[model samples]
Target chain A: MREIFKQEIEQLGLDLVSMAEHMSSAIDKATTALEKADLTLAEQVIDADESIDEIEQRIDEQAVSLLARQQPVATDLRVVVTALRLSATLERMGDLARHVADVARGRYPEVAAAQGRSYDILLDMARQASKVGTQVVELLRTNDLALAASIESDDEVLDRLHEQSFQVVLDEDEDLTRQQIVDVVLLGRYLERFGDHGVSVARRISFLVTGDLTNAVAMVAETSPRNSETS
Target chain B: MREIFKQEIEQLGLDLVSMAEHMSSAIDKATTALEKADLTLAEQVIDADESIDEIEQRIDEQAVSLLARQQPVATDLRVVVTALRLSATLERMGDLARHVADVARGRYPEVAAAQGRSYDILLDMARQASKVGTQVVELLRTNDLALAASIESDDEVLDRLHEQSFQVVLDEDEDLTRQQIVDVVLLGRYLERFGDHGVSVARRISFLVTGDLTNAVAMVAETSPRNSETS
Candidate 1:
């Protein structure tokens, strides 16, 4: 029975990695759609959100079932709990990406040309975030604390880029309408938050690996730059 | 042994409620400080964050210890797990409030007078959020799903107020600069998100009682208005 339960938990971990990969891809495609103002790609991402939601629900059910049946303890219990938490964060990230796509779809025609440069910066941030997401899953799969810590460090770069994009949008000409600037700033804020969620997942991974939550926050603070150079 | 474990778990629950109360009060004070431009109050909130963090860490340790020693199953397991999740969310909410206060202190003298009306709107929103927070603790104490669902409904008012405040800051020429307006908008966002965290806690309570998560999302969707609101 213990061997069977261990096998089930291992499979659940694989399922979680698969779901995270799907989310990572969705984020990348959504970012691309936003950059190019491609309505078709945006629609694809919006449509894909349901699948992400479904996967999240499935993961939650699986975790609950595992808890009920296997009665997992110690590190096994932590792994299942962490997977559940990570799934929620991943779902939220997908929702944020969907939000960005919706915003892009709404403002496409009006600011397409003006948003070209800004979109590039946003895409860079999204790519960095996607990479971090991948690393988070990898860390979970391999139980790699150092790799998770490194992924956490990557969040600082995303934060810097996010802040820089905010300054770029805000420092633009005063003559520009509020809506135009608001859109750009909102986009930057969304990406910054997406990065935060990625950091959150990495933190969860760290907790699972070491059974210590405080270390993740401490490491993140130490790695984050003192200068707030993004502005 | 079972009785002792149950007693310990109950104690952990009470501690969680206490921590949530402290967090809710800290956020309230922080919001008021932001509105009043009270540096001392803002500093107080910042100082209080350490206590919140400490409580959160304690709750986590207690929950993990309970899981390892008692090996709680079914509802008992759910309660302990929920407590862990709740503390994590509460800690983040406290951090968000502190961030708002930091922004408030950052604005300081320039926003002291002009920010009054905006602060009024924010204060009202914070009050609503506090009510929801209180309701969440009550629901947890009673394990009452009905009360949790009702608290979920109240989140709508907070959402609308947040939207109205954001629009006012953006559309009206309130003697404040663009950065000031952005600061005000971000402050509202934080309060609105505080309400979100409240709803989340309530949802977790509902889940603990009924073992269902679908209804919680439905409640949030029902409360949300037709138009998309920025956070």
Candidate 2:
């Protein structure tokens, strides 16, 4: 019975890693679609989010089943519960990637970003978001604490880029239209939230590794930076 | 043993209702703060969120404890797991309310919503969101399937208000400043998501009362409408 439980737990981790990989791909493709105004790639990303959602549902069922069959206690129980929460976070990350694609699709013929600096800033934000997405996959696959710690700094980079995107709109000299300003605000927000959810995944993994209840509690308590106007 | 499990489950339901009450109050205060540009009230809502987070943590710990101590299976198991998920949703609702308050506080001394028609639309969104929040509390307390069903229509009202807000910004005649436009977009998104979370809670409750796995699975599958541009 113990051996079976161990195997089930390992399988749960692998399933989560697979979900993270799909999420990473969605982020990369969404970014490229945004950069090039590629309608086909954008449509593909939009279509693919359904599969990510389905994966999450499957993981959730498996986790619940494990809890029912094994009735894991203490550390083992925490692992199962954390898996459930982590899958939800990954699912939300997929949704954020899809939102990015929506912005790309919404401005199909016209790129969402303004020309020159604003465009460069958006591309930079997308790159940072994609980088964070990759790191999330690596952290999930290997359980590397250092990699998990690095996710926070990567998220900080994304936050800075998001702020700069806003600055580009707020700058009096930029001369962006209202539509461009709205797109920039919404896009920056979506990408920044993607990075934030990546940090959330890392924090949860670290708690699982360290068995720190404080970390688990703090992870959920931290507000997304953009949501807090003071940030 | 069965009686003890029953009582614990009842306690979990009551705890959720308490959390929903806090959430409902936060929504009411957040809307009032936005309408009146009341900085102190906004600050109150923001600070109160920490307590809401604490309540969620407590509820989670209790639910986990119930699972571990009782080793409940089948329907009993689903009850505890659903409690855990519902608390998370309620916690997020608190965060959304906090975000709304942040917007109000950030624009302190000046209203987040522009005057005239734009102002009315934002207030309407807030009121609808507050109504949904109240209905969530009622559903948690009474397990009323009809009330659960009503939340969807309330969310629709919020969606319409959100779109009207966008139209207010896009209308050439409105002449909203860039900052005002950004505020409107962010606020509308926040309120819409609040309504979405309320609908999620309602669906989960309905699933619990009806013992319908389809409702459980389908609830999370529904994407927030505004996230899809086609909506």
Candidate 3:
């Protein structure tokens, strides 16, 4: 019985990692579709998001059932439940990818790129976000506290890229309309928030393992817009 | 022991309601500050958000303890855990309010109105969102399935108002700089998403009471931007 329970929980972790992989690819394709105005890729990303949502729901149910059946106390319960919340965050990341695809699709046939836009910067932001996604799966697999904690540091680059993307758009003097400007703002916000959610999952996993969150609070300061508003 | 558990669970419901009340007011003051560009009120909202985050964390800790100690199964388990998730959502609403205040504070000395924007429509959207917050707390206290279900119907107006807020911004012919345009979009989105979280809580509470989610899915269609993009 003990072995079966242990295996089931391990499988739960695998499912979470699988979902993370799916979400990472979705964001990567989403940005590609956005940059190139590839309707086909955009549609694919949008259509594929259902799978992320489905997997997330499945992981949630599995966690709940584990809680109910095993009634695991202390560390085990935290592991199961925090996995559930992290899955929700991952699901949100997928939705942000979908939002980007939708914007790409909405501006199809027209170059969706803002005038004087930092196209490479935006692509780099997506890559960094996807990297964080990959690192999270590793964290889950290895329970590597060091890897989990590094997301905060890595996210610093993503935050700078996020701000730079906006600066690029804002500084442009040529043919930047209100709609395009709003889209750029949304794009920056989506990419930055993607990193923020990534940080949230990492911090959560680290806290789950070590019960330390000093780094998480500091990290949230850099990524969260609300936190930045006052300072 | 059984009776004590039931009462403790009931108290948990009350605690959630209290947190929701705090969130609703934060949003209220946030919008008022935005409209008046009242820096003090905006500062107040920003500073007070820590209390919301703190309460949410305390509630989370309490819920974990409830789950660990009660070892509740099935419906009882659902109640405790879902309450935890809802508190997270409610906490997010507070963040949205903070976002609003941040925008207000960021645009000091300026009126901070969306350019050629319908200020009343935006204010009305905030009111509707706060209304949903109040209703959800009531539903939690009463287990009023009817009240829970009504959020969908009531949200339709908020959705329309959300759409109109954007249309007014888009349709404007005045000199709306890119920054103003971006601010309007953010304002509309934050207000609309605020209500979406409220509906989510109401829908979940309904599901908690009677195990029906068909309504919840339909209701989300009106508010979630990702859902609208594909449809």
Best candidate, DockQ: 2
Which stretch of 10 consecutive residues in model 1 chain A shows the poorest summed lDDT? A222-231
Evaluated on CA atoms against the true complex, candidate 2 attains a DockQ of 0.55
Candidate 3: list runs displaced more than 4 Å: A118-120, A172-174, A213-231, B118-120, B213-231
lDDT of 1 by residue, A38-112 (tens): 888877877887777777777877887888777777788788877877787887777777767777677665433
CAPRI category for model 1: acceptable
Task: Give lDDT: candidate 1, residue B129.
Answer: 67
lDDT string for model 2 (B1-231, tens) is 889989988988888999999999999999999999999999999999988888888899999999889988888898899999999999889988999999899888998866667778988999998888888888888888999888866677888787788777777698677778778777777888898898888888888888888876777677466343322
Order of all candidates by TM-score, from best down to worst?
2, 3, 1
The pairs that clash in candidate 3 are none
In the range B84-177, model 1's lDDT, one tens digit per residue, is: 8888777777777676667656667544324556656777876786676667667767878778778777888888888777676666575545
Instruction: Return whichever of 2 and 3 wins on TM-score.
Output: 2
List the candidate numbers ranked by DockQ, top first.
2, 3, 1
Off by over 4 Å in 2: A226-231, B226-231
By lDDT: ranked, best first? 2, 3, 1
Candidate 3 or 1, higher lDDT: 3
> Which model, 1 or 2, shows the larger DockQ?
2
Q: How many residue pairs clash in each candidate?
A: 0, 0, 0
